[model samples]
Target: MSKRKKHNLQWIKETLELKEDHNWKSQPGTRIFVAGRGALRFDVPQDWHFEPDTKSFRFLDKKPPNDDCRLEASFNLLPPGEWADFPLVHLLKQVVRDDERNPIEQGEIIRLKRQTARIVWTQFKFIDPQENREAYSRICIGLGSGVQCLITFDYWVDDAERLTPVWDTVMESLVLGLYIRDPRTGLAFPD
Candidate 1:
């Protein structure tokens, strides 16, 4: 087993801001493999398919063992000082301002572990007019050193309560690597 790094724990905790009832006791979601370097580990209820190529996890309502949930997460490595160019507040508003998107709730969330960092939270309608399905999405973006991680949890409007917990689990269990691997040498992440 590849050893998980502990140095990023503070950033994870600050971004998550978990609630009281969260299952913090080693709850494993579905195991999804990421090609090339590392893998993402999290536990989703069951029957959810994670497509690594697209970096999307989805389970359709019409499908078998239907979970009626759709979740997607992406990590974008930003250029040095890129985060400063696009502040979290501006990003939050931009999401709701364009494409006729309406936000049910949106704001900046507290970074419990870091006073300097910013995390934005937004809930909006993700409409697919072609499919006639309008899903409710909860997005949280955590700005980190040269990295911007976006975790989106969406489900059919009626299934929000049932599927929200799955999203919560992903947020609580998420662990991203801090180091870049060097095939010629070994592991590298500056201390």
Candidate 2:
């Protein structure tokens, strides 16, 4: 018959370790979790994969027989006085306005529910360098399709640092997973 399915326990274990090492904090009233060290965080039913050499973490959601999503947050440690010189708010705006890449509208929020979560779409932008340029906009699509919600979280970078690039990559990755063409083909793990 069929071979045993390989479980991603290793990835899960590593993610826990990383979370502990960073003393990650969970946002109040939200399923999202964040590690301030590298501004690392991901949605629920998701896990993390760490690459020590690269000092990066990949947040992956592997729900079998349905959908999957991956968001990677990498750390590029800068010297005491050298950091990505870019405004985080500006980058957020760019991501949201890039409608061609992401279907986010300005000042629009949609509430959605999936089989896994009840998400709220709230626009946010913060100018914390340690956190770098951070922004999000779009529907809080989760749980099932019936309760899918839409929200906008557009933001941009105020500085001219390379952090925006990293943010862009992570955002694209997450969006792609959320809007997969076929759920059957979107499974990140086996049943």
Best by TM-score: 1
Q: Per-residue alpha-carbon lDDT of model 2 for 1-191, expressed as tens digits?
A: 00124444443233322322342333332234333221223433224322221333333333322212223333222234421233333444554565443332245443333233333333434333434533332322222212222222223433214233333333332221123222223222211
Q: Candidate 2: what lDDT?
A: 0.31
* lDDT (Cα atoms) of all candidates against the true structure: 0.51, 0.31
Once fitted onto the true fold, the runs of candidate 1 whose alpha carbons sit more than 4 angstroms away are: 1-43, 54-67, 82-86, 101-118, 125-134, 180-191
Q: TM-scores for all candidates? A: 0.57, 0.28
The lDDT leader among the candidates is 1
Q: Candidate 1: lDDT over CA atoms?
A: 0.51
Tens digits of lDDT, candidate 1, 1-191: 01112332222112235455543344554443221232233456555554332433343323434445556667765666655546776676666566354454444443312323345666776564545676776776666555566766656777777776776665655544334354223243433
In model 1, pairs of residues that clash are 28-43, 29-42, 29-43, 29-44, 30-43, 30-44
- RMSD (CA, angstroms), candidate 1: 11.6
